[model samples]
Target: MQPLADRLRPRTLDEVAGQQHLIGASGVLRKIVESGVIPNMVFYGPPGIGKTTVANIISQVTSRRLYRLNGTTASIGDVKAIVDELDTFLTPDGALLYLDEIQYFNKKQQQTLLSHMENGKLTLIASTTENPYFYIYPAVLSRLTVFEFKPLKKEDVESVVLRAFDTLRGESGESFVLEQGVAGYLAAACAGDVRKAVGAAELAWLTCPPEDGQRRITLAACEAVAQRSSMRYDRDGDSHFDLLSALHKSIRGSDPDAAVHYLARLLLADDLPSVCRRLLAIASEDVGLAWPQAVSIVKSCVDSALQLGMPEARLPLTEAALLLATAPKSNSALMAIERAIADIQAGRIGDVPDHLKDGHYAGAEKLGHAVGYRYPHDFEHHYTPQQYLPDELKGAHYYDYGPNKFEQANKNYWDEIKKKHR
Candidate 1:
């Protein structure tokens, strides 16, 4: 009942498609296996990116005894049973206990491993999709070196997909025809998850009835299968955050093409609300003052989107995204507000000048509130120098406007006014 991904799992270290950083010849694992003394470690990363495969490869190459457990289901009793079994073996490096989703282990179950790990009964290889610091117990973490497994690259996924077909042909003597670029399409669509890529390919394979005694898979077939999988828009998952991030960064970096690409991805995810919110923030925080009108444009786009919904709404959104991507970018306003906030948080406080205090209240005249106020309308150019900040930050400079043509006039006006004060 093993899936195609598991069945086609790489057997040797050299066979792993990606993860060259950790499993290459000069990798830490290689050094450990070469030394014949494997230690406890944790492999942290997203799923289907070869955590279990890497662990299996390490155990085989190092000739260490291997025991596998799932954190969600494994218990203290299971740990005891495995340790008890391994206790009878006189292996020098002890057995390797591979626990998937190690974050699911409760403190009590994890506690059972403390003595076993310390005594060399098991060299633990724990894996988790969540952050290890937040999920793994400090005691268990202290004994394991953490290694991160990145999602496999597009080429890696393609290689895995192609290899599966190779195995199918070798076993059945039937050639599976992969339409040109179908492998790449599946690879890219899986978001670097090799296992997901294989599953998609498998679905496409199963859906295709053989023509002339050979199966042919195309992008359309893979997409048809992907419709029922995670390729659908996940509004609250990692991909949601990733697409929003990509869109923001692309606009900030002045890449209209990339910004539009990420926008399309968000639309594919069907997360219109999140897209609108992120666009609004980007217009203000990123495109602030540079293209002050960007705020209105993006807001109009969002308003139209909410009113009309998708497909039709994508037009205005695209226009706003393109406008932001091509606009000169700055964050001076955001930085200025944050700096002011920090000053307040650091206990910066000052009494308002009598002239600036609330003088509209009863007895305000006796308190000298507004007594010495200098009306700016009475001064030349209807402008007068005044201290608006708290006493401690009277002349603090926060805004650093970039080379934006739209803000140049504002910056020049300040430059002349500040000169008068100087």
Candidate 2:
């Protein structure tokens, strides 16, 4: 039997669950599809996000010969067979091939399509759940334009679930009772995968018990079908880094609640190392010299998290997040280093002052190394103003006092000392 998802697969761009940026009116993809000249394109994104559906829509609108291949099983021989069909009367106008999971194809397999693509014998629309640039052969990837398909929103998934429900009802010719919020529950549980949402709705309906001569689709039934909320996280994909960014930004923004929420999401995805690393970085990058001790405290929390692992680890990780979010935030250190590095990169690195060079070596003092170097410790208040920066970067200020109590206090102390000494 055709699965409900396949049966209800969108026949037009308008019916696709998400990715309006690509297929909506005024979208570049819509313009391309309507132009009747399809190029070799790669659809990049997670599964159940309408890559195949968009490819199908393109095929329908262009009235081109359509061929489908799964990278998991399609061999070079299969590709050769398709190539051999190019000259046949059936595909005189060239063929449109939809290659799903293109990342699974080996380099050689990917290269096999290059000649056809180069000569306009075939227009390829390949899709992959992984980052295509990382997986596709450079030669093959260079020739294909890439478009990203994002996950469906909750409302979009709910719409799909309700549509499937309506279809099932029409097919069964029976009045089914759908409990309030059941559709939304299934939609949220599917984690933006429309295919999963539809399948769960079908399962819920199939397993639903008939009460009073009607199969009541209840929230409990939907939950049973969904099993558990699926996390939209992939260690190698964008979601992983996106969640990490969310956590970092939340902590930097001083929202402990949001910080913990994002932290929980990462932990639920079993991304302990990523969270720990980001937290450690946040200590120095965001908290910086404002709360110098924050680095040590976060480090301890990270250590405890690594040793504890998972369920127990979440506790330390949570503590670390709370500490960071509530701590005084500053990026002065980060800005200082970045500015210095930018100067170095731009060829602003003048020779180190002779006074700052290694003077402990024999003959170094004779060579003017450390010749004029003043021992600040020998001066009053252990202070001396001397040339430290390179000649090219004289008087350049890198470090800025951050606007925090700790930094401001230290800044005031240094200001007084420098004022008296100079």
Candidate 3:
């Protein structure tokens, strides 16, 4: 028996589910199809979002010769062989070449396709799960129109489930009824992936006993087959963004346990890069001078992520998470920048005081530059505030030291220096 995904593979755009933004009546792709003027395009999206299906649809609609290659398995020689085949069947009307996982193609292999696409020898349609702007070569990217495909929605997944169930009943002639909750459960567990939804449905049918003709699929059965009780935490989805928000708030709130829990969730979901980036933000925003080492630790973790990649990189990420959770919290540095930005946006522009302007340049001294600027090093504790700020905001104070240990110590140091100056 054929697998559900294969059995239900869409043969036309009408049969393909979801991605209304691309395939709807007034969608960009629909316009391209109606015009019969398909350009070289790169399909940037997650897996099983009908990239290949759409490519096949285009080939069918246009009656173009289609040559498909899997980047994971196809060799350079295989690519050349296909190109050779294209040459044999070469006509005034060009052919379409579909490359799967185009990111997996090394620089040289990607370069090989440049001329073919440029000269219109083949209408190139490439697909990848990764962002092409980062992974694809610049030269190749310049010549391609990039289309992003989003994951299938829950309703779309449910629709596919019903269609699959109908197909199964029609083929098997066995009355199989899915419980009311089973469809929703299966759809949710699939995480916006139609392929997984069909697989789970098929698994439930296969595992049912032959004697139980009236067997109904349950949540337990679905969970057992899907290997998850509910939707998995998608790093690019709502849960990911929400958890990061909570993590940042917890760190700012100085709640170590809550911060740790959020960190653990992100780690388990394999969102290490985003975790590191957010931690870096927290370091500057919440830690600042209160715990200066926190920023360095976060930076080091980001570097470690670049060096180690996944699995091993989780270690440094864990260290950074713990440090951020326990670090003394302050928002003074964050407030300082926020205030500066607010002033700028409010049209509080100020000229560089003549005394502070560059003096090393030829005409600097003639323009009264560096005329009255005091050298702070010559003063006690290297401290001086000789009108550094503009006249309009001379007495403006942005950073108010918080009640953290490091902040209090810094406040004391500044106070003593101010006393000497006064």
Candidate 4:
């Protein structure tokens, strides 16, 4: 018997659960299919969304025989066999080739399809759970129109779950009634994955015991099958980077709630090192010199986290996140370094001023190293103004004081000392 997910596979665009943006009455894809000229395209998004279903529908609408291949196992030979069929009387005009998880295909394998796509021997619809721009070679990527399939909404999942339950009930030849809210519960628990929701509904129906001569599918049964809400995270994929980016941005934006929320999500995936590394970077890159001690404090938190390990590690990490969110924010240090690098890259580098050059070496005096240098400790307030930057960068300011208490205080002290020197 086929899995419920496979049994429920949508055979037409109208049967697909979501992706109204692509298959709705006015959707771009719908218009393309109606025009009877389906071009090569790539579907990019998470799984259990309707990429394959839509591709299948496009093949049917365009009256082309569909050939499905999984990139994980399909070899160059498999593709060639399909190409061989193009010359057959049965597939005279051409055929649609559906490649799933296309990212798994190596560059050479991906390239092999280019000639076929260009010659119209194959109309390609490739799908990936990754960003194609990063995985697909430009030669192949440039040939396909890319469409992004978003996760199904809760209501859409609920509708699909109810439909699956009805199908299961009829197929089993048993009387079963879904408890109120069972579909909605499964929908929310599945986290916008229509296939998962359908599977859960099928499981709930099978595991449910008959009461009063009819089986009752309850929310509890659905919960047991669904378990924890599905989380779309791959440590090596965009989900990993996307969550890390969210956590960092939340901290940088000064929202402790959002910061901790994303942190918990990453930690739940057991990605301790990534979360720790990102937090440490946030301390210096985002908090920066505004609270110079932030680096040290975050470092200690990270060290303790590494030693304590997960669950417990979350404690110190949480503290670190809260502290960073509450701390004064600054990017002046980050911007300062960036500006300096830009100058160097643009050939603005000048010879080191003689007074700032290394003078401890023998023969340095002959080269005028450290000449005319003023020792600040020999003056009042340990302060003296002298040329420190390269001669070409004289009077150039790379760092402007960030509008924070600690920075402003340091800025005031330096300003006063320079005023006294003047």
Candidate 5:
């Protein structure tokens, strides 16, 4: 028997539930599908959310040839073989090559696609349950636009559940009774996974046989099935990113309570590494220079989490997140480096001054390298001043001190030193 998910697969963009941001009246994907001109892009989100289904629908709607290659099951050789055959295909209108779980393709395997995506033998419509930017080769990612799929809102899931009810009646040709709140309960339990939602409804049917009257589906029946399923996390879904953002921002915003709440969400999903990695970043980007010790503390917590492993790992992870949340916040260090790097990249400055160049080489003094260099220790306050920036950017200031104790103190000292030098 076909799975309820496949049976209820949406044939048109309008038939697709949720993703209003993508398939709504003004959605980018809706426009692409309607225009009958689709580009190579990846549908990125958690599983059972219509990445593959959307790809299939696009091909059918546009009447385009489709070539599917499973990244996990298909070898590099298999991909090449398909592409080679496709190069000589009779279809004038190019095909849509649907690669499911494209994250499984390693760098070497994905490298093969650089040519096809460039030459356009086919339009690539890849689907992934992992973040494409992290798992996919940069070359592959560069060639394809990423369309993020967010989790379905509750009302959206309820609408799908209501539709599934109709589909079941037509399929079974029997009167089915959906008890009050049963559909909503199922929808809520599935966590935006339509397959789970539809399947649970189907599973509930098996629990109670058809009688002379309507076979009513109840929340109790659905709850038994929900027990086997885990949390509603699509690790690659936008919710994952959203919750992480919430956690980071909460910590940076100085609310440890909100930070811990978001951290708990990831812990339930067993995504501690992502949390830890974010904590480390928050330590630098948000807490930066203000505490200065936050980076080391987060790093230790990462080690402890890995060594201790999960459940228990949540402890150190929580500590790390809280530490970041409570730490003094400043971006002076991060912003300063960013501006300096930008300057170098834009070629906004000349070569290092002669005084700043390496002068401890043969005959270097004769060429006046380090000619006017002043050792800071050779003067009062051990802070003799001289031009350190490139000749074209002399006295250029990059580091702007925020009004934080750590940075403000340093700024005052620099100001005083500059006064003495002047």
Candidate 6:
């Protein structure tokens, strides 16, 4: 049996669901189709947003001989064979070559397409979930325009549900009445993914028992089959933004347990890279100089993830999250830099004192550069109050050390130095 997604696959641009930004009137794609001019391009986005479907539609609309290949399995020889076949079918006429998961193609395999794209022999339309700018070859990327397809919206998912339910009804002869909440429940579970929504609807049908040979699909029935409570976390909506906000706040609030909990949820849902990146920001933004080690630890987790990948790599992330949550919290460093930026933008610029200016440049000595600069090592405690900040910020204090052992000791040491210098 054909999968629900496959059965309802869009045969034309009109039937295609979602990605109104790309297919709407006056959209780049719509314009291209209308003008009968298709360019070599890359569709960079997440899974199941119609990259393949769009490619197929373009071929049909343009009446071009389309050759589709999976980048993961196709070899250089296979690509060459297709190119040879394409040559015979053309006399200055163009063809569309669709490559799925283009990132799976290593640099050597990618090089095979550079000449073809450059010479305008084929209109290459490639799709990749990974960032093509990082994964694709520079030469190949340079020859293609990149279009980003955003995840489908909830409304789009709902539209798909309505269509699927209608189709099911037609086939089953009203055997099932799709309850009002059933459509909403399935749509939410799909998470801005039309494919998943269709799959959930099919599951609901299979699980519901026939009433007089007519099955009635309800919210509970869908939930039982899908094994998901609700689709409240719309990947492309406000809930998505809200989850990230809560995750950041949970860390900043200094609850290690809560931090770990949120981190676990995100990781379990496969948002590790984003979690790692956000932790890096939190280290400097929330922990700052209060615990300088936090930044390095977060960075280490990121590197570790890149090295070990998933499942095994989650340990480093867990360690980093716990360290950040327990670390002394302060926004002093974040604030201080922001204040400095404001000063600069407000044109409160001050001249560099002669002693602090670079002495390695020509005629620096005559210019009084490095004139009165004192070596802190020459003094006891390796401390000196020689001016470092500009005059406007000379006595301004930024970091107020927290109650942590290391910060306390450093604070005492700096306090004694300030007294001696005064």
Q: List the candidate numbers ranked by TM-score, top first.
A: 4, 2, 1, 5, 3, 6
Q: Which whole-number lDDT from 0 to 100 does residue 82 have in model 6?
A: 68
Candidate 3 clashes between residue pairs 3 or more apart in a chain or in different chains: none
Local accuracy of candidate 1 as per-residue lDDT tens digits, 1-422: 78888888888878888888888877886677667677889998878888888788778765667788999898888888877776465555577788888888988888888988998777888998776877788998999999988887888888888887787667657678888888888888887788888888888888887778888877799888765344534454445666788899999999999999989878866788888898899999998998788898889989998899988888889988999999888898999899878877888767776688878889999989878777889987677887666677687787787778878888898788778867
- Provide C-alpha RMSD values for all models, in order: 3.5, 2.9, 8.8, 2.0, 5.7, 9.3
My TM-score estimates for the predictions, one after another, are 0.84, 0.87, 0.67, 0.94, 0.69, 0.66
Whole-model lDDT values for every prediction: 0.82, 0.90, 0.81, 0.90, 0.83, 0.79
Span of ten consecutive residues with least summed lDDT in model 5: 86-95
The digit string of per-residue lDDT tens for model 5 on 279-315 reads 8889999989888888998999999998998899999
* Model 5: residue 246 alpha-carbon error in angstroms: 4.4
Candidate 3 residue-wise lDDT, 166-235, digit = tens: 8887887778767678888788778777888998888887787445555566667887898752444667
Better of 3 and 4 by TM-score: 4
TM-score of 5: 0.69
Better-scoring candidate (lDDT), 3 or 4: 4
On TM-score, the candidate that comes out on top is 4
- Model 6 lDDT per residue over 26-52, tens place: 688878877887888889876777888
- Descending-lDDT candidate ranking: 2, 4, 5, 1, 3, 6
Go through the candidates in order and give the clash count of each.
1, 0, 0, 0, 0, 2
- For model 3, the local distance difference test gives 0.81
lDDT of 5: 0.83
- On the 0 to 100 scale, the lDDT of residue 99 in model 3 is 93
